[model samples]
Target: MSYFGGQPTNPFGAPTPKPPILKRQVPPLPENLDMATLADIRCSVNIFSPATGEIIEVVVGVEKRKFHVHDQILRSGSAFFKTALSKEWKEGKTRVVLLPDDAASLVDRYVQWLYTGKVGVTLDNGKTDYATLAGLYCLGEKLMHDAFQDRIVDALVSGTREPNNNAGHPTTCSFPMKDVVDDIYKGTPKGSPARRFMVDMHVMQGTSGWIDVERPESVNHEFAVDLAFAMMQERAVTGETKTKHAELNRGIPCSYHKHGKDGVCGGKA
Candidate 1:
């Protein structure tokens, strides 16, 4: 229950999504912080470091949870875009330490596991727990790499739009739907990078199962396929041409296209 203008109302209004409170292993600590750190985090850079070199290095400190770590320096070997983005504003090419707080949260999740040698993510009680869950999702993605993040995102976004269902995304998948939806609605438009960054959807499993990092290969593929298939099916069902997919299952065509050459239509037309 959240107090909106002094009135207690459902955090998730009509949809009544699974609450972040329910997922909490520890109740909201007024500001329960789970800190993280990254050290020598090196990723590949184009034309900056021999087509691959040091991208960022960071060390995080969380006053609570006794979580502290100095990760093995990170380095990338041949990559284009860099996600280790920073606002420090250096000359030409520079290292990015400490991702934004929200992004760093993910790094903490990974380091915490490596340090304690323990999987901290567990559904301890029947409260909508966002903090712990969010941390776990971030950690899992960080450690496991893009596959993990992609899997989680696909699962979370399943049924969120047309592509999800077409890809065989299951309804049982757990990804923070409510929080993400709230974040999207509450966040500023695309222009507002700050607000966009603040809107982290690492937690929101809606009417889905628990957000566990088990079986990534199966889960992600199934979800992606479901999303793709569902999207194609939706297009056909709606008699939409030229455009192979629709947005949000609302029969609205997207201006752009993606995926392999086949994509939504699969060149059947």
Candidate 2:
């Protein structure tokens, strides 16, 4: 048979239609191409200039683990470091800063975030590592980095609201456990954004089973009081026990953010 399965012809003796054109596969560029020659290539912020500044040795945790970070980047990103690295401080003279109380792993994460605006944490069973994030928040608080703390809050909110890989893709928004709560409450002071966010989470999505009444230690005293007061205020205003979990979980992104008088919400101008 012909290529068209037979000699195909038009009834009016018109020209037969041409076959569809096949697209040619273009080969990828070679691995050793000169990247500098590419036009309009945006460059990242020059956070690392080894030749320009001195290196600060940060000794963290009881183990005395050391991280040699660029002084300029560290000072530029952290208020604590900026103050500590100043000429008036002993750390500045010694060129070494010590954080004996903070967790080394968390310090490592902070360092990673300092270098690249992102850091990764190990998840448990495909679930977000709330405890690790909580630790990072506490570390950020200690470091006096509002931007870092705000980022942690954002991570917490996004992680909780993410859909699980279950049959229904249900949202497994588990409130921070007792240890996490204790760590946060102990690390952060009253009215801290982390504390407020925890209180709000419990008020919206908490259940009786979330707290073990028999084990009083499982609940932080301040957290329990805050939860009760929040629940009462909600009931008084709305006149119902219905929880606004959905709204709290997915509402305004800046609801739990910490902003100054003129500072913008969600860290944007």
Candidate 3:
């Protein structure tokens, strides 16, 4: 009997041939490769050589606090720098980038992220500095640094996950207050990751008393409208009762990420 019913007649004519399986061949390693040399090559390709690269002065804020940064590092990390430092621009000729509108502290944080790949957002009181992180996100957006914005999102998410110690009261992670929300809304456009994050945080963790007392008049009209729509959507999916903060916390991190594509979180792989 053939594999298919009533099809046994063709079996004697010719056996069907199977397709060949192709294997991918990787190049062989060098016979006498030096590990130290290989390591050095990798480092040279990955790390910016501040010593060899030309230094550029970034004049930040109204006071024009000068921050000396490596041009190579700036161009490599930020699209704004890449364009501004190109041959056509005056900034390229002078090697001095002025950012008069941005805060000096935020620009300093950007410089720090360029070198260290880390963002510092913790305050002395053990609370996360949402205000600074929000500002950094805006700065990253202005600078066209997608990776930096993603990093700031990661910091925001991580900050909210940690137990915040407020005085001697019970530990609870509070979302960013009114001023931070206003700043983010003003700086970013609609459908921004930070805005979505704020909406999600409030919808998941917020109580009526918290809104009425803790953040009275903090939520602006735009934010309130977005929150209302998001809440309706959430209710449609999960039913009328508020979704637990634990369930919301258990959601995927990528949902809060700001990368261009869906399901793809940028910055770290």
Candidate 4:
């Protein structure tokens, strides 16, 4: 259901926009990643952003996240909801509330973010926390639930976010693709347009790309594979089946985004 009144519930799923995953040529590797042993990086969760009143089903990998543990991470992808909404994680000696809902089957993507600080998704999952929060800040961004979306945005923006990287591009297109992917996998609606103010910090690292992509995914696994390829591709040394390279730029082509994507990729603020 559209929680944003007339906005597309799942924009990425439709039309399946052409991804910016290019190498000055069409790639012939993405389709065969199935042989790469799709490692499971998902986690079942019930997340309540007290900030936005959003109750979410989080998919996380095996990472030690102190965000708001509603469930225990015994293994990977094996978890239970926190019973109720009051199971806010505390310091010590706090009671972890239990839930009575059947919120299972949400995993992998979230775990990707926990381990690598990034996530990605298709129509079959929930949006990662970071990307979902970014969408909320832009407002009008498509979302599974308005209140919940707002809460996630509120949490990250509410705090002091330390500099993660120098070339951290936060726009929908150049957006931490992996993070947005995580959110999409978890079923978070892509965002509408973003405001200049919001785009400045997140999109452009406090600079621009406010409106263009509602929910941005690389259109294919090429984005991620290409990225990983970039680092290792050149280092494969004699093509010994190890290391590759990636080709990522700020050209995913997303408009209709609110603030007009006023920044450059890699957060050029």
Q: Which candidate number would show the highest lDDT if scored against the true structure?
A: 3
The stretch of ten residues in a row with the least summed lDDT in candidate 2 is 1-10
Candidate 2 whole-model C-alpha lDDT, 0 to 1: 0.66
Q: Return the TM-score for candidate 2, rounded to 2 decimals.
A: 0.67
Q: Please report the TM-score between candidate 3 and the true structure.
A: 0.66
| lDDT (0 to 1) per candidate | 0.31, 0.66, 0.67, 0.30
Which is the better candidate, 1 or 3, if ranked by TM-score? 3
Assess the local accuracy of residue 215 in candidate 2 as a C-alpha lDDT between 0 and 100: 87
lDDT tens digits, residues 1-269, model 4? Answer: 00111111122233212234324442221121222223332312212111122323332224422223222221111222222223454411243322222121222223223222222322232222445444433321221233323333444443224333333543322234444533333342223222222323342341224323455453334333433444454443443322221121234333333446574445333
Tell me the spans in candidate 2 whose CA falls farther than 4 Å from its real position. Answer: 1-52, 122-124, 166-171, 236-269
Candidate 3 Cα misplacement greater than 4 A, ranges: 1-52, 167-171, 210-218, 236-269
TM-score of each model, paired residue for residue? 0.28, 0.67, 0.66, 0.21
Model 1, global lDDT: 0.31
Please report how far candidate 2 places residue 22 from its true position, in Å. 44
Residues 96-191 of candidate 1 have per-residue lDDT tens digits of: 343333444545544333222222332333223334444444544333333233333333333233222323653433334334333433322333
Candidate 4 wrongly placed segments (more than 4 Å): 1-145, 158-160, 165-175, 179-203, 206-269
lDDT string for model 3 (67-123, tens) is: 877666677657788899998999999999999999988887676555434444777
Between prediction 1 and prediction 4, the one with superior TM-score is: 1
Clashing pairs in 3: none
